[model samples]
Target chain A: MMQEIILGDYDLIPDTIPSEGELHLRVKPIDMVTYWRRCGAVANFIANFYRNPQDEIYHLNENLISTTFNELIENAAKYSTKRDSDIDISLKLYNTILKMEVENICSQKHMEAFQKSMEKIIDSDNDELDNFYLNKIEAKHAGDKDSGIGLLMLKKDYSLQLSAKITPIEGEVYRVSVHAYYNMSVE
Target chain B: MELKAGESILKYNSADQTVTIEGSMRLANLMEYDKVSVFLNDAATQASDKLTLDMTKLNFLNSSGITTLSMFILATKKRQNPKLNILGTALFAWQEKSLKNFNKLWNEVEISIQ
Candidate 1:
């Protein structure tokens, strides 16, 4: 049974129930302004959702939400190919861990390098990560079309996994999904 | 770049080594690396022995913005400036942490968060 939840431009999957809450954000060049606005909106929404009086499962902090959305929007802006392409965003709270998945359209080559960069960044803390970001920015050397560490940093700091694959739908339109996790250790 | 807020227009004087980032020092359209590199190059070219970042009405700044500020601090340190002053009023918590973070890299860049 698939659930349906619609918020903003996204049509949430399995739109039947809220067993595990979810939010879907559609990404398009036209919605660039709204996309950034929704990034903050989703961050605050996650904070409020977990801080509910009725729920005692997981504690979602503001920094985690902010970091998650910041990375998500960065990826969305970088990967969304079409002017009106929608980026699918969904968050699931499973037991003590919260999983966030952001999917959009991009090439597989971009996903590979993005994954490697993310692992390296996640392995370091604030100081090292800052240096790495600076080095990359200074290098100014990337593939002809690269998304850089936008996806990688998210998964690294937030324990994210980008399940990037070419989903061939309607001839040659491919979709990519990037997932990030927030667990008990995230403080 | 000129950004219009409520009643004032935020300006970045590329030639003067002074950028008045008001309202939100954070720009959504800019990526972290791109912003840092641009600021560093600009600071290197425009600034002299002293670099002044006039953040009077800045209410919000993200991690990238922090990185940009740190880069400015780093550039001044590389140049061995006598006084790398970051003057501002009413800075956000992130900005304070960013200043502290920069202190770790270049201790002499005096930051006053009023």
Candidate 2:
């Protein structure tokens, strides 16, 4: 049986990043104006963190770190309440697996749009998923679509396992947390 | 042609037909990325023979960023297709995987990894 989404306490991350196996970062009440800038900085930090400690993971894939980290943060911010809400992001490495989590506040309208996209991902097989991504790219390139392609690439290109939870915190306000896992050894 | 957005720099050298992308590019969405492809596609059509994109220092690229490159590659099927070349580094895992996808999308695209 498939486990349900976890909407419990999502604030268990410590204040600082660990030396060898974990890293965490948080920026609350962010606005769209500065969202891209912030995600770039944190992605570089996480990518370098695992890459610098070469003893922990041989030949660290910094691009993987950057791609995965940025994609999640960007999506979180897009749906986020921008100016007045918190957006939390974290990364942890254990036994050749790197896990990333992002929690951000979003609106009911954004929640519905995002959930529809996620359903396509969860329902498709590898082949179906690939076609869906390519079609999205083509449509977007031709100026006919605005569907975000980050999460699709997260799974197809990076082989990440993605799971998300959207829960209402108040009227018209919701909290969305997406957890992604990347198996470094498999690649 | 050159596009400088904060730390990111996208320089297209018309004389040498090269597009060099350095720093991180995390644009707002695919729409933003389409502008990049439009710029590249325009450059490709004007190229007399060939075009090269150097991503050696481009450490971060969201899917939208890579999608822009793929769109550029697919554009080669057009009548005025220029011989496309991509130069990237292998140390960056994203480049290592993402760069190869270009050839898979359009096999004739020339790629060099250092």
Candidate 3:
């Protein structure tokens, strides 16, 4: 069976951005887990690549972009079922709006869990999201590992529109593509 | 006591009852943040009157790090002894936004952003 789900603002993810304003990075999940620092390094590189010295908000946007990208990369690396497979990350700039997409292979179990979290975020109002985030933090258990706080924090902290597309691959594995749109003009 | 990993540094000064976290922290997962959680929890326990967390120099922190901090805050709230005071700088946009969310966790938490 093949399935696809779009959470929010799926139409905003364009087919392309100008060559000068687009960047793509590919990394294996194994390297991300073994060398944890690679996540920050990749994020910083992409942030720097998009920074414009002429813009007065360069420093602020640089930090914000890096933090956003870092979370996406970390989540992709953590949930991926095939450690040796490549996770593709693409960043595009359309005027003041920045679009980021990350695609990775995950087991059916992981994809289902990810979809549930994304759905909650897209469905909640501002107050509900805040309460949900706080409850998750307070309900932390010793054995319960996945907090799903990264995506929640992004939803709560930034003016980012989030969505994901899941495509069935084989028996229980699937390819999940997560998309995020951030409007720098608002900041 | 201090924990230095990658580009970040976490330090505790018993004399001043302050834990200064500098640089960026992007630890992989919850397990990787255990040491930092322990450090902050220890600092929380040792402070009798007030515990201050200075994050002015911390330019970046991933969600895992934020969760660790939130857990530390909740534990301190449960103890209800050492009042928690977090010192952040408005220079970092995240501090202006995310740090305030700590207040919702514990309203009594005093957050001062300079």
**By TM-score, who's the top model here?**
3
Which one wins by DockQ: 1 or 3? 3
Determine the TM-score of chain B of model 1: 0.64
Per-residue CA lDDT of model 2 for A79-102, tens digit only, reads 776566778887787657677888
Best by DockQ: 3
Candidate 3 CAPRI assessment class: medium
Clashing pairs in 2: A29-A85
The list of candidate 2 runs beyond 4 A from truth reads: A1-22, A29-32, A50-59, B30-35
Per-residue lDDT over A33-102 for candidate 1, one digit per residue giving the tens place of the 0 to 100 score: 4445455555456555556545465445554555566557655655566757777776776566666776
Of models 1 and 3, which has the larger lDDT? 3
Off by over 4 Å in 1: A1-20, A27-29, A33-49, A53-58, A108-131, A140-173, B1-26, B31-67, B82-114
Q: Which window of ten consecutive residues has the lowest lDDT sum in model 1 chain A? A: A1-10
Cα-based RMSD of candidate 2: 4.4
lDDT of 3 at A42: 94
DockQ for every model, please: 0.18, 0.61, 0.75
Candidate 3 on B1-110: residue-level lDDT in tens? 88895689989999999999999998887788898888888888888889999999999989888888888788888889699999999877678768988999899999
Candidate that would win on lDDT: 3
True contacts kept of each: 0.02, 0.72, 0.74
| lDDT comparing candidate 3 with the true structure | 0.85
Candidate 1 interface RMSD, angstroms, 1 decimal:
5.3
Q: What local lDDT score does residue A3 receive in model 2, on the 0 to 100 scale?
A: 31
